[model samples]
Target chain A: MSLSRSSAIPRSALTTMAASRRTVLRGMALSGLAVGGANLLAACGGDDDSGPSSGSGATVKFGINEADGSGPAYDRLKGMADAYTKETDTKVSLNAVDHNTFQESINTYLQGTPDDVFTWFAGFRMAQFAENGLITDLSDVWPIDGLNDSFKQASTAPDGKQYFVPVSYYPWAVFYRKSVFEKNGWVAPETNDDFMALMDDMQGKGITPFAFGDKDGWPAMGTFDILNMRLNGFDFHMSLMAGDEAWDGDEVKLVFDTWRTLLPYHQADPLGRTWQEAATAMGKGECGMYLLGTFVVDALGENGEDLDFFTFPQLDSSIPADSLDAPIDGFCVAAAGQNQEAGKEMIKWLGSAQAADAGNNAADAPFIAANSGASTSTYSDLQKKSVEVVSAAANIAQFMDRDTNADFANTVMIPSIQEFLKNPDDIDGITASIQEQANSIF
Target chain B: MTDIEQTRAEAPQQQRAAAPPQGREKKLPTRDRWVVITMVTIPLVLVVLLVWVPAALSFALSFGKWNGFGDLDTIEWVGFQNYKDIATIYPPFWPAIQHNLIWLVFLFLFPTVLGMLLAVVLDREMRGSRFYQTAFYMPVVLSMALIGFIWQLFYSRDQGLINDVFGTQIDWYGDPDINLWAVLVATAWRHTGYIMLIYLAGLKGVDASLREAAAVDGAGEVKTFFNVIFPVMRPINLIVIVIVVIESLRAFDIVWVINKGRNGLEVIGALVAQNVIGEATRYGFGSALAVIMMLISSVFITIYLRNVFREERTR
Candidate 1:
C-alpha cells in the first residue's frame, strides 16, 4: 500500500551493491566479455538528493550525459567533483545519464530552473543556449585560464564572447588495417593516384576498401568530406562553410561524384550498422579500411588491438588533409547557475592540460590533448598520429552536419547520404531535396 | 460498576430520551463549517489546478503557433488555421490517419481471433494448462523498448534471427515495402499476450451448462462453440475490441523506436511525436495532431460506451 524509500536500510546492503558493481566492471573488461553482443557500461541519471543541504552544507547537482567511451574520465570527473565538494564543504552529486536520455534531462533542466551545473557541447549547438540566454558567457573565465586564442576562435560566439570551455577537441582521420596494407605491398598513399590505386588494388582483392557504418548516416559523410577537401581544397571548403552558394557548384559535384563512384565497394548490408560495428569488421581485417574520427578509438579496442591509421590520403597533397568528424565536447556554466564562482573554478580546472591527461588515460581516449604543446604519449600510436595529422593541417572544416542545422543535418542530410549510398542513382533527386531542405531552413 | 452502568445507560439515552433534546442539542462551534470548507476546498482546488488547467491549455494551444517554449504570451493566435492545416493539408496527415485506421483493424481482428482460439484451447484444463497461461502472457512483462530493439534485430537483413532462419536477406527496416508490417509484428507480439489473458477470463466466466446443453442437442464441437460459447463472450469481445482500437490509434513507442518516425512511414502518433519531441518544435502543430487523435479515438470509445448502455438495458 505504501510506495516510499523513506525507510532506512542497514549499511551492509550499500557495501554489497558497491562491491558487486566493481566485480561487474572487472568482469566486463576482460577479453571476450560478451559473445556476439558487445556490452558497454550503462549511463543513468536523476536522483533524489534535492533541497538545501541543511546542516550537511550546500550541495550542487551535476549531470554528465555518459557516452560509452573511456571509463576513466567519468571516474576522474566524479573524483574532481568529490574533491570540490570536500574542499568547499559542498556536497557534489554527479549524475551519469545515458546519451539517449540526454535530450529529456536537458530539456527538463532548461525548462525548470536547474539546481546543477550540466555539460554542453561547443559550436553551433551552443547557439540555441546563447539565443535563449540560457548559457553563461565565459569570456572572463576564458582569458583568466590562458587557453590559447587559436582554439577559442574556432568555437567562440560571433559576439566575441565565449559560451563554453573546450574540455576536449577530437582528432579525426581515416583508419586503415596495417596487416592489409602490409600484405598488399602498399605504402601509405601520398598522391591522388596512389590513393585510388591502393583502393582499386584492395577492391580487386575483394576487400571492401572503405568499410563504413552508415547506420548512423554520418559515417558515410567521412568519405564525402575528405573528397570535398581533395577536390575543392581547404579554402573552398571554408567558403562553402561560410554559407557561400558555391557549395553546390561544379567543384562540389566533383566531390559528390567521387562518392558516387565508390558505391560498388560498399555494397554489403551497409544500411543501419553503427560505426563501432563497422570498425569491428575492419579491425578483424575483414574489410580494408574505415574512415572515422579518432573518437572511434573507444570502439575499436575490443581485444586491445587498435587499428592503425593515416591522415586521410591526400588527392593533391596541396589540399588540406583532415578527418571528417572532428567536433568539440566542452562544458559551460548555465546563465543562471547558482554557483557561478564555483563553476568558473571548475572550468579553469577542466581547460588545463592536466585535465586532458586525466581524461585520456583510458585505453580508448580518442585523440591527443587539444592544447598544442601538451604531451599525449598515453594515446595509441595510431591515435597520436591522427592528432598530429589534424594539428599539422593549415586549415580545417567543421563536420558538415555540425556546421548546419542539427534537424536538417540528421534528418535530411544523413538519410540522403544513406539512400545515395544504397544506390548512387538517387544523387540528383537527393541532392535537390537536400538543397531544398537547406534553403527552407536557412 | 455504578459509573460503568451510568455510561452504558447514557449511550442509549439519545435513543431513549435525549431525542427530545435534538432540536436544541449542544451545537459545536460554527468554526467547524470553515473546516469542512477547508477540507473540500483543498481537493477541489487541486483537481481544477492539475487536471482542468492542463486540459484547457491543451485545447487552447491547439489553435496557436507556439513552438514549445517560453512565455505563454509569446504564443501566436492562429485561429482554426492549425486545425485546417492538420485535417487535410499537412503532408503527414491523411496517409498517417489511413495507416492508423489500418492499425485499428489489425489491432482488433487479429488479436480477437487469436486470443479466443488460445483462450478456448487453454480453458480446456489440459495438461500444464497453468504453465501455458504463464508462458503465453510472458511478453506482457517485457519493456516495449527492449521488445522494439529485439524485433529490429529479428527484422535485420544481416545476422538477424529471421533472415538466418529464412535464408533470405530482406531489408526489413530500409525496404519501405514491408517496414510497417515489420513494426506491426512487434506491436502484435506484445499485445497478443494480454488480449489472450482477457479471453482466458471470459472463457472462465462462460456457464458450463450451456456448452453441455449445446452438445446434448447434437451440435458438433464447432457448432457448439459458435452457438453456445460465442454468445457468452460478446461482453469480453466488446472490451477487447475497444481496448485494441484505443491502443492501435495511439501506437507510438514501437514505430518511434524502429525509425524515429522516418523512412517514409508516417502515422498520427509518430507525426505528433515528430512535431513535439523530434527535431521540430512545432508544439501547436503537435497539439493539433493530439486533438485529432483524441477525436478519432472517441469514435471507438462512443461505440463501446453505447454498447455498454445497450447491454445494461437488455440485462
Candidate 2:
C-alpha cells in the first residue's frame, strides 16, 4: 500500500501532462469502439483525468456533482476552480455531472480512475470509502482555522484520521412561514409538552400541524433522524445507523410509537405527495410547518423570503436538544488520483474561509460556508440562520442515507420506510424486517 | 435504386445460388468467403460477449458478495446466502413476483382483446378511418418515459387533472391498492395501439373472397369473422399473443420512471436495476434477483418455443 501511494505522486503528474495529450489522439481512434458497450470504462477513464490544455502548471481534476450550463452551484464551483488556478497556478479541471447521476455512479467513479479532488458528503459514507482505501488520508490537512472541532469530528473516519474537508452544510429543522405563525399567535416550541400543545392548537384551528411527504422515499428519513436523536440521543442514533443497535429493540419501537401518535397531525396520504408539493402547502399556509433541510426554499421559490425555522423541540429532558441532522457537503482526494500533492493542497485551501468567500461571491445562491471566517455580508437571512443553528448544535448527524451503508439505506431502509408509511401500525413487523436485512448486510 | 427494388432483383439470384451449396462452395470467390466470415463472426462475437457473458457472470456472481469494486479477488464467496436472505427476509421480492404475474394477466386480458376489437372495426375502411387509425396509434410512438410523465399530470393527488375533473382526491400513483391498476391503464393505452397496428396489417392480408363467400352463405359480419377470418388469421393471433406476453414480462420503463418500482410497483426488472444499477452495487444480492428473473423468462420462452415448433410440425 505504501509503495503504491508513493508511486502515485509522480505517476499522476506525468499522466496529467503526457498521457492526457496522447489520450486525445487515442480517444479519436477508439471513439467507435467506446461508443458501443464494453469499452465505456476505458473511454470514461480517458476523458476524466486530463483535458486538451496540458499547461506547464500543476493540474487537479475536480469532479463536481452539479451539472454544467447556468446554475448557482455550477457558478460557485467554477469560481472556486478559477480562484484555485489564479492563486496557486494549479489548473483545476471541472467535470460537471447531474447531481443524482453523480451520486448513483459514485462507486464506479471512485473505483475507476477518479478525479484528483471530488465532491462528497462527510459521514458514514466517507468513512466506508476511507476504510476501503478508495479515498486518501487527509489528517495532515487538518487544523484549518475557522473550522470547528465538530466539523473535524464529522470529517474523521473510524481509523482516527480525517478523510473529508468540510466546505458547506445545511440543517434539517421545523420550517414555517413567519406571517402564518404571527397571524395565528403561535410560537416555536421548546419542550415535548409545548410541541404537543402546539400541534393540538394547530389541529383545533383546522390546520395540519405538519406538511409531510414520502413519495420519493427519502424525505421521511429527516423526520426519523430527528425523532431518534431527540428520544434516544445521538450516540444511540449513530449506533443504530452503524448496525450496532438492534433495529427491533424497545428504543426503536419507542421512536416509531411516538411517531405514530403524531402521524394524525401530518398531511394525509403523504405517499402520494412529493416534498416539493408538501413544502408548497406550508408556503400557502395550508399546513402549519414542514420538517426538512434548509433547501426547502427551493420548493418555496419566491415565497421563501417568508420562511423561518426552529430546531425540533427537546423530547427527553435527560438528552438536550443539541443534536440535529446537518449533513455536511465536502471534498475528498481519491486514492486512485495521480496528483495527490496538488489534490491535498487544493483540499487544504478549500477548507479555508477564503475559498468559501470566493465561492459565495461567484453565485446568486450563496452557501452557508462551514468556515466561521467566511464573509456574511452576501448571505440571505435564512443562510445566516442556518449557519447559526448548525454552529450551536453540540452533536450533528448526517441525514440517514449519508450515515449508513449505501446498499442498506437505499435497498432496505427506503422500502422499509415506505412500508411503514403505508402501515404505521405494523411497527413490529417493519422493525423485524429491517433488523433481518441489516443483520445480513452488516 | 431503393432497398425494395434491390432486394427484388437479388432475391431470385440468391435463391438459385443457394440451391446447390456444394457447387457454390467450390466456385465461391475468396473475397465473398471473407465477407461472409466477417458478417457471421461479428454478430456471433457480439451476442456471446454482450448477452451470454453477462448472463453467465450474473450466475457466477450470485454465489459471491461483491460491491463492484477492486479485483476479482475481492469477491467473497457466500454460497447461497444471498438467495437465502432474499427468500426469507427481503420485503420487495414477493411483491415483485406478484406484480409481474399481474402485469402479464392484465395485458393479455384487456389490451390484447381491445386491440383486436379495434382492428376489426377499423378494417371496414369507413369514412375518416385513416384518421382514427392514426389517432389510436399515436401513443405507441411516444416513449414509455414520456408516457409516464403525461400520466403524472393526470395522477398527482393534490393538484392532478383527475381530482380536478372528478372533485375527489384519489392517490393514483401512491396508494398501493390502486397505483398498480392506474399504471396498468397507462401501459394498456400504449399496448393497445401496438397490438391494433399488428392486427390491422393481418386483417388487410385476409383474402376478401373468403368473407364474400361467408356473406353469400347468409353469414353476418360477426359470424364470418369468427368462422372464416379468425381461423385463417391464426398466424397473426399467435404473433399478437407472443408480443403481449413479451411486453408484459419486459414491462419496466414506465414503472421505473414513476418511482424506481417502489410503493406497490415492484417489478422484477426494477428490483434488479435498483440493486445493480448506479451506486447500489450489491452484486451478489442483485445477481440472485436477476437469476430468478431469467429462470422465470426461460419458462415462458420454453412454452412459446414449444407451441411454435408444434404448430410448424403440424403444418
Candidate 3:
C-alpha cells in the first residue's frame, strides 16, 4: 500500500507539473502580448490596416449585440446589413455576440478591438463612451433626412455632439389585452383617480391589477421612471437620474411611497417571477395589466394584435403624464475601429427611412423605427398606437437604467429597487440606502 | 514495517546515497543544468507573472478609484475610501458575507452528511446499488450553470413543475427570505452528488479487514463505521472539508445564472463580478471586494495547508 501510494504521488505530481508547464507556455504567449509594452504597441500598429480608409467597396465591420440565428432581432440586423451592402456595394462584415455578454463586456470591447460600427443604446452609457473617446464623434451624421429632432437629441452626447444614430425606439407603457379590457367595458385611465378606480375594479373581480415581476431587476425601473416623471415632473426625474439630486430627498421618497401603495395590486412575490411570466399572466387574462415595453409582445408570442397600451396616468395634477421612457436603440462608431469613414457612412445610411423599411420588412417582428419617414404600413395596431403616443409625448426620458450612471444604476438602483419591492413599507430606509450608494458612485 | 514499506521509506535516502557528494561534484552537465534551470525558472516566472502579479495589482488597485477607462494614469488614489464605503454604505457587502457563511454551513450540514450516508449505504453493494450510485452522481457531472437552469424548471414561480404539481403559489426563486434557502436546496442537489462520489471513492479505498475486525468483535455496522472506518478515513474527511470550503467561497455561477446574485443571493464572488465584469466599471471598489474575499479565502487556506503539512510531517 505504501509503495503504491508513493508511486501514485509522484505520478500525480509529474502530471500536474507537466500540465502546468503547458499552461505556463500558453500563458506566457498570451500575456506576452497583454503585458509586454512593446508587443502591445506592435499589436496596435498591426491593427491599422484591418479596414480600408475609403467608403466605396470597403468592408465595415458591424458588431451586433444579438447572436447570429437567434431570432427576429438578428434577422433585422442582418436584413439591414444586406440592404446596405446591396445599395452601397460595400461589404458589412458581422461580429455578433450574445446580448448580455455584449452589454457586460462593452467597456473592454470598446477599449479593445471593437468593430467599426456597433449596436448600442442612446443613453448615459453612450455619452460616457463618447466622453472617454472610446466612440467616434458622429456630429457629421446629424441632420439625417428621415430622423426627427427628438431622435437627434436622444443621439447627442453631453458635449452637444451627435455620437449615436438611433435606428429604433420603444416606449414603456401600461399594456393590457384589448379583448379583456373590451370584455370588461374598461377604458384606459387618464388621471390618478381613474387609475385607482381601474385597479379597484380589477381587484373586485378577483383579478390581479398588475402583472409585475422584477427578478431581472430592471423591469421595475420602468414603473419608477413613469412614477417619478409623473409625480416630480420630467426635469427633476432627469436631474435625479443624472445624480444631481439626493435620492433621500422628498422627490425620490415620494416615488417609493406611491409605489408602496400600489404594491398590493401587483402580482405577489414578484422577485421570483420573470417579466415573461408576468406578461404571460396578463396574456392569459389572469392579470388586468402589465406596465412594460412593447417587447412584452415578444414574450406572449403574439403579433400584438390583442395588445393595446396607454402611457401611465398622471399621478399629480400639476405634472403631465406626457413624459415617458422611450429608450432608443442605435449604433455608434468605435474610434478604435480602422474604417472610421466607412463606419460613419454606413451609420448615416442606417439612420435613413430606407434602412428602417428594409429591417422591418425582413423581420418577423418590427420595431417602431425612429425615422419618421419609415413606412408604418407593416406596423401592428399596438405599434402604430405606440408610435402615435411616443410622437405626441411632450418629453421622452430613457429608462432609469439608461438615464443614470451605469455604476449607480446597476450596483445601487437595481438592488435598492428590489429592496423596496421586498419591503414596501421601508421607503425612508430604501431611499436613504440608495442616496448613500449614489453619493459614493457619483 | 513490511519489506515493501521499508524499501519505499528508504527509497529517498537510497537515491541521495546513489548521487555524488554535495557541492561542485554534485552539479549536472552544463546542458543538463541549463535545461533544469530553464524548466524551474520558466514556471516560477510564469506563476509570479500570471497569479501573483494580478493578485498584487488587485491589492494596489483596491486603494484607488478607476472606471476601467483611459490609461493607468486615470486611476485616482483614494486610500482606503473604497473599503470604507463597502463596509459602511454598500448594501450587498454584509449580506454577501452572511450568505457565504450560510452557504458554507448549509453545504457542510446537509450535503456532506447526506453524501457520506449515501456513500456508506451504496458501499454495501446491495441490489441496484450501482443504479442508485449513477442516479446520485448524475448531477455532479453537470456544471453549476446547467444545474441552475435544470432547477429553474422546478423552482420557477408560475410555470415550474413544483407549483404545477403541488398547486402552491410559492415564489421559490424571488422572495428574499425564501430564495436563499431555495437556491441552497438546488446547490445541495448538485453538491450531494459531488460529495457522495468523493466519499464513495474514499469508502472503496477503506480496507475490508478493518470492518471485519469490528464485526468479529460484535460491533454493529454503525459502530464499525464510527469506531474504525471513520478514523481510518481522516485524510478523506479533511479533503472533503477543504472541498466544501472552497466550493462555498466560489459559489457564484448558480446564483449568477438565477438572478446575477441580486435580491438576497449576493455572494461575494457574484458581487465582485457584478462590479468588475459588467459595465458597472467600479474597478477599485471591485478590487476592494476582491481583496476582502482573498483575505477570507487565505485564512481558510492557511489553516488547511498547515493541517495538511502537519499531517504529512507526522506521517
- Residue A243, candidate 1: Cα error in Å is 7.4
Q: Candidate 3 on B220-283: residue-level lDDT in tens?
A: 9888788777877887999899999989998888898899999989998888877866668787
Off by over 4 Å in 2: A1-56, B1-34
lDDT digits (tens) for residues A1-442 of candidate 3: 1221211121122111222232234334323323352344456575466545656577888999999888989999999999999998899999888897689667656765678999999999899889999899999878999888888889998899999999999999999999999999899998889999999999999899999999999999999998899999999998899999989998888888888889999999988889999999999999999999999988998688888898898889887778999999989999977779899999999999999999998898888899999999988898899899999998999898899899988899899899988888889988898888887878
- Model 2 docking grade: acceptable
Worst 10 residues of 2 chain A by lDDT: A7-16
Clashing pairs in 3: A271-B174, A272-B174
State chain A's TM-score for model 3.
0.90
**Global local distance difference test of model 1:** 0.62
lDDT of candidate 2 over A265-336, digit per residue (tens) = 999999878999999999899999999998899887773678899999999889999999999998999998
| Model 1 lDDT tens row, A209-261 | 87776655566766776677777776576456445654346776677787777
Q: Which ten residues in a row have the lowest lDDT in candidate 1 chain A?
A: A1-10
Interface RMSD of every candidate? 13.6, 11.0, 12.6
Lowest-sum lDDT 10-residue window in model 3 chain B: B1-10
Tens-digit per-residue lDDT, B1-315, candidate 2: 132245445756787777876664576688988998999999999777545765677777789887755666777999999999888999999998999999999999999899999999999999999999999999999977689889999999988999999998899999999999999999999999999999999999876777777788898988889877887787799899888877776667788778888999998877776776635668788878878887888888899899999976653
Cα deviation of A46, candidate 3, in Å:
7.9
Ranking by TM-score: 3, 2, 1
Of the candidates shown, which would achieve the greatest lDDT relative to the real structure? Answer: 3
Model 3: docking quality category: acceptable
